[model samples]
Target: MQRKFACFGGSFDPPHFGHLRIIESVLNAKEIDKLFLVPNFLNPFKSHFYFSPKLRLEWLRILCKESLKVWADKIEILDYEVRQNAPIPTYQTLQFIQQTYSLTPKDKMYLLVGADNVESLHKWQNFDWLQNNVEFVIIPRKGFRIPQNFQTLPFCAMDISSTQIRNKLACSDFVELSRLIPQPILELILKEINCKKIDKK
Candidate 1:
């Protein structure tokens, strides 16, 4: 049987419930054999991050562990981006997967993104190559307007954002953070916060 792979790349500085729901929704809806949750070392579009790439990878691993409760063997946290010293574009990452895995012609691949990304899809590096070479699973973001004719998958519409979580963390507001963030992931974030405090001292 041919295997179908989907790549879900993001700067999951601290993976939260919304992100998990999106991944689960994709797994439940798609005919995918494996779903890779790749954490980028540097997001080309975004400039600042609260946690380092290494810490982010650690958080993703914690998320994968928690995700196993739902889909036992489907979720994988890939570190291809974190291993890179420089920023690598999404298209290049996909190319590396194709070459590294020696994917057969019969094997299928797809890219997953939220509606906000779809709105700015034209601004991405090598947009034409990305569009022509890979299929996409556009996920719906709470506020962003999705374009017509795009195949959007159902993700839980939570009014949560990574930025909001980061703000709560910075303010030491664990109550709100706990509501939006997963327990294991929150534990990892607390460790990162302590490390930052130690670095400052």
Candidate 2:
């Protein structure tokens, strides 16, 4: 049987507890055989704000190591988006995965996103192409409503975000964030932050 996969793409400037929770939830739900945690090389919309792809990939690797789920694949980090200097469109990434993984009509490929993105789906580049090619698994975000056209899955509304975690780290208040991320990933984040501070000095 062909393995079904769900692709969750983001800059993941700092992998937070919320992201790990979503991955665990999705995996435990058995919605897909495998999950691809795709970290963008450069996000077009959020280009002004993001960490280097190398750092983001490193953080993701640490998160994966800490995750109990073994089915999550880091294939997205190795994707063309990371290789190309230019911004990679989401539809293009989906197409490449489809061809590379030999995904068939019977084999499902879900584009996992947060509820906030679901509401703004129409604004995404090649939105029509995305709707035609892949199904979606949306995790609820605080204060975001489910769209009418898309089917909402039963997922926890994770209130944490990478931005919030970064802000906390900036203030040296990683205690709350520590509770969110796995110990291994939290240690890595702390180490990276300290290294950056030392370099700045």
lDDT by residue for model 1 (1-201), tens: 687999999998778988888887888899888888899998998777668888888887877776656675777777898898667799989888888877777888889988888868888899998877778878887778877777778776678888898889889999999998888788877986798799999
lDDT of 1 at 158: 75
Model 1 alpha-carbon miss at residue 92, Å = 0.5
The parts of candidate 1 lying over 4 Å away from their true place are: none
Give the RMSD in angstroms, all C-alphas superposed, for model 2: 2.4
Model 1 CA lDDT for position 181: 89
**C-alpha RMSD of each candidate structure in angstroms:** 1.6, 2.4
- Candidate 2 matches the true fold with a TM-score of 0.88
Q: How close is candidate 1 to the true structure, as a TM-score?
A: 0.93
| lDDT tens readout by residue for model 2, 12-85 | 87777777777777777655666777788877777454467777778787777656436545233344676776
